[model samples]
Target: MLTDPSPTRIDEATIRALPKAEVHVHLEGTFALADILFLAKENGEYLPGPAATLFDITTHDAFAAPAVSTGGGAGAGAAGLSGFLRFLDWQCGLVRTPAQAARVAYAFAARQSASGVRYSDVIVNPTHWNAWRGREIALMRALSAGFDEAEQDGLCAVGIAYSLLRSQSAASAVDAVATLASARPGHVVAISVDGDEKVTGRTGEKFHEAFRLARATGFRRTVHAGESSGPDGVWDALDLLFAERIDHGVRAVEDPALLARLAADGISLGVCPRSNLTLGIYRSWDEHPLPRLLAAGVEVTLNTDDPAPLGSCLEADWAVTAEQFGFDEATMIGFAARSIEASFADDDRKAALRSELAAVVDERSRTGALSS
Candidate 1:
């Protein structure tokens, strides 16, 4: 017999111990303040504030205010998505060599490992790495080297998702897809599009050709939509880009038809609740649409879109989701299973992960740990 999905239970420790998959994290957004300081010092760059002070400000005030311009092109204070992107651009500029890229990747995996993330699909936009302007292949190789090292250490298995910026021209998007298809980095598995959806308006038609080409080349697709835009953006992503998964697609709750379609098609939404809150997408966790989406039968998975920047982790995300939504152990475990199913990992890996999760759940159940 199965436990009730809606039972009133809170198990923070068990939630932390659950093996999960994070499919929406960004490589550009995972750099710690220490990492940033080290990179800046190594490259003779300057930052707005002391490393500790800056980290404290960004993490604590992330949702209090929009990121303010520091007059140095990078954002300061608790910046929103646009400001964060500028800071991310500046950070990416510091990584001038493949070795630097590898280090970043390795550190990101190490962090995820500490949070019990067994697998990760990390998104990286090549356009952000201005330092490696014409050396995209070298950059990919460097990132792959880092992830390979992390895997060897039993940290986590990672796959790269090459992301297209919505602000870029169609030609640039096509070029990126072509580069990804040609390079075919061992760790590269999917193509994604991310940017200021409010500025770009979630217009998927702009990159239809690029996404189509990516699909033809055997790459899976995901799109960032419904975070800043609306259900229309999510619709455009499905209709135009043929996205297999949607990132931050909570706005689908507003459209009954869209919810029905998603449930019928079994499409998964990689939701980042804290990201939505910090970005001003919702006033509070109580106001979030996740509960409604779940009730509507939509497959939902929790994630940290930009963990370091938002001061969030996969474990924390799940814990908060349970606390806020009153999710029981069974419901929480279902989210974990959904994450694995929605991932682009191979069937063998997915099967193994599922079995591992099942064993954990069984052990916890037999020991009565989940009910505690």
Candidate 2:
């Protein structure tokens, strides 16, 4: 039944209840169409599409909002990833004040809480928030203030990781890092470079100094690579930026050497299968290398890269990947445990989260609710 094209038989509710951490999600792209409509109307931005059509649009079909009609790109469907990206740019442009940024953070945490994600390290690239470009520190504070409120309400504990757009100039990268490093924002935990590596070409050298400065300042490092580029991009992130984790490093399987190094070094990959499938990274789930990577001992933790527009959720990721790969309950738990261990959260928080995961598993095991 493993690797069968048929949908997984695992209990999705069980997966939804598991204590988990989401590490690779992007705040800019996390908004639902409903959220998009709400945020747009609130800020008085032009409606992206007709209200009736947009409200009826599901996340799975959101990518098809005509690019030419929206902002003009490749076309529709997968071409609409660009369309969606433009959608994000438009939505993100609506945040003109710190209060708006805080609201975005609080809403993001609440959404994650509904999915049972106890903690999250969300990627927030200032470049996406064109309105807040010059005032990054204030932006960070506003987001943190929002997250702090959510946490107080017993929602997921959220940490911000500034994702440097890959296409930004090296000087721009350094300046961003310098500003963040100087402020040392408590809520912002890591520094990451995310964008189209295929389009931006190699950026390891471009971000080396910035990452070095970040590392020296005790900020964690993660990089978006191996998704758009090949194994070489992963290597550049590892060697150049000293990234502790590589987002979408699925392509590492292409190089035996790189794959071996990743495992031996215990580098984690925050793999987002739905994102990959939506973007046509693999033609089908059967073609995905997630199973192979797990077998190869990669510390792979599942995530929904762009949850809203991609129509993704963490529980579905766990259930589907478990059934598709024939993973046992222990394997699913291992992935969840690794997500906590791999987090940029402090040692005490990590321990608490790990305890929470263990407690949930034990309770489920006793109640006979677990699938396997």
Candidate 3:
């Protein structure tokens, strides 16, 4: 029997206890302060100050400063989204060997598991790995080994989405898609594009051939759009790349026709509320378009785009969205279902997860334990 997807008051504890899947997390953005400090020590690198100082600028108050783009894309400088990208690049640069990459990958999956994530489709943009760009196959294998360790430990099942940076050359994007295509299929499930949409201006036309190659090679597609840009970016991602899902597509709220198309086509939007606020995309949670998107029948799923940099996590994102949107236990469960439905996890894994989620919801419903 299908449970009603109506609002029913739930609490933070209930939200945390629910099994979930995170599809928009970045491997480059999962580094903790301690991890950074440790990595710096291991690499014999110097820090300007304490590790905490590196992340202090991500606070809401700090975001009041105008963001400056360094023209090379988000990874170009240390301010705003560009600063976050620089941080990501610095973190990626810290891993100088396949072994180090494996360690980071394992730690990422382990962290997500602690947050109650049963499955994660973590994105790793090869363009950021200046050290390992030409050696992506080795990097993927190392990361896969680490993910294999986590899966064997019964922590969380993991998959990679080989991401392309819009700032990178078209040749590099094509090479990335080709690399992922030739990689072990179990390690990579999708090809995605991410970076400052503002820098690239949502011109999906730039990578049309690459995406066509990805589709022809049998890889699923997702694209980052509608975050810094507008609804047109999301449309380009759909109309040009034929993306199976969208990352940070909340700007679709600005276009009714786009919203209708999303609903009609059943496309999923990986929405990140805290990332939006921290990035100054929206002023507040109430001002976010998640509620509006859900009301329009869009399949919206919550995610933590970059947990450490944004100082948010999957559970926290869910809790904040629930509180802001007045989502009840039922609606919360519906979000979980939507995530599972939208994920690139194989049908068998999806079936198992859906069953587990349904069982949990039913149990909570019977025990009336959804409230604090």
Count of backbone clashes, every candidate in sequence: 1, 1, 1
In order, the Cα lDDT scores of the candidates are 0.81, 0.79, 0.78
> Candidate 2: lDDT of 63?
39
What's each prediction's TM-score?
0.91, 0.91, 0.91
- For candidate 2, the clash count comes to 1
Clashing pairs in 1: 67-79
lDDT of 3 by residue, 1-372 (tens): 022333554555677677889898888878888777877889998764555567654442322234653221222223666555656666677887777778888899888888878898899887677788678888888888889887898888888998887877778778778766776545788888887777767669988988999999988899999888789988999999989999988889999999999999999998888777766777776678887898899999888887886676778778767766666767788888888888888999999998999889778778877542
| Candidate 2 segments whose C-alpha is farther than 4 A from its true place | 1-8, 52-76
Worst 10 residues of 2 by lDDT: 67-76
True-vs-predicted CA distance for residue 341, candidate 3, Å: 0.7
Error of 2 at 326 (Å): 2.4
Error of 1 at 226 (Å): 1.0
State the weakest 10-residue window (summed lDDT) of model 1.
Answer: 68-77
lDDT by residue for model 2 over 242-285, one digit each (tens)? Answer: 99998889999899899899999999998988777666677788
Q: What lDDT would candidate 2 get against the real structure? A: 0.79
